[model samples]
Target: MEILKKSQSGSFESSDIIILIEPVEPNSGRNIDIDSSVMLEYGDTIKALITSKLDSYNISDIHLIAKDKGALELTINARLETAIKRACNIQKATMH
Candidate 1:
């Protein structure tokens, strides 16, 4: 889904991550930045996870800022997905 506006998810709490995303010009490519307490140990891993998640959504033109506080993979996944949904103007899933 296309990013309609800037959106954020998660928190600065321990073992959590905050994901902030902003819309960029079409076809401009992704600008994924990472800030983590474990940067020296898992920087590449975090970047890969974020890149894979963005790719899954086919989001090529966005500026994503991931601030991590030693969160696990699952948390990262969830936060990023939630941020994407919010940026796309989705409040919640609809049920039929």
Candidate 2:
């Protein structure tokens, strides 16, 4: 996302959204925190997608941080969407 400013303590402006990626730790029975790239788009599609997905999955605590890479408008959005879904185990499990 176009970060006009950065916050060190998870403090974001009205224009920014925070995503938390919480995955269960194997054998440890604990959760791991992961961050996603910030999404940059004029529209609210990215935020909407992330909000819906996060709510649907009921994930918490894990923090996500995203940095734009000059992707197509939808590229970053799609990437984040894919990343979240995959991280939440909604996507088909693949061997890679």
**Candidate 1 lDDT, tens digit per residue, 1-96?**
689999999999999999999999998888888999999999999999998998898888899999999999999999988899888887686321
RMSD of 1: 2.8
- The whole-model C-alpha lDDT of candidate 1 against the native structure comes to 0.91
- Residue-level lDDT for 33 in candidate 2: 31
* Candidate-wise lDDT, in order: 0.91, 0.41
Cα TM-score per model: 0.92, 0.38
After superposition, which runs of candidate 2 have C-alpha atoms over 4 Å from their true positions?
1-61, 93-96
Tens-digit lDDT string for candidate 2 (1-96): 111121222123333333334343333332323332433343355445545555555544334444333334455445555556655555566431
Cα RMSD to the true fold for all candidates: 2.8, 11.4
Which residue pairs does candidate 2 place in steric collision? 1-38, 35-64, 36-65, 37-66, 38-66, 38-67
Q: What is the Cα root-mean-square deviation between model 2 and the actual structure?
A: 11.4
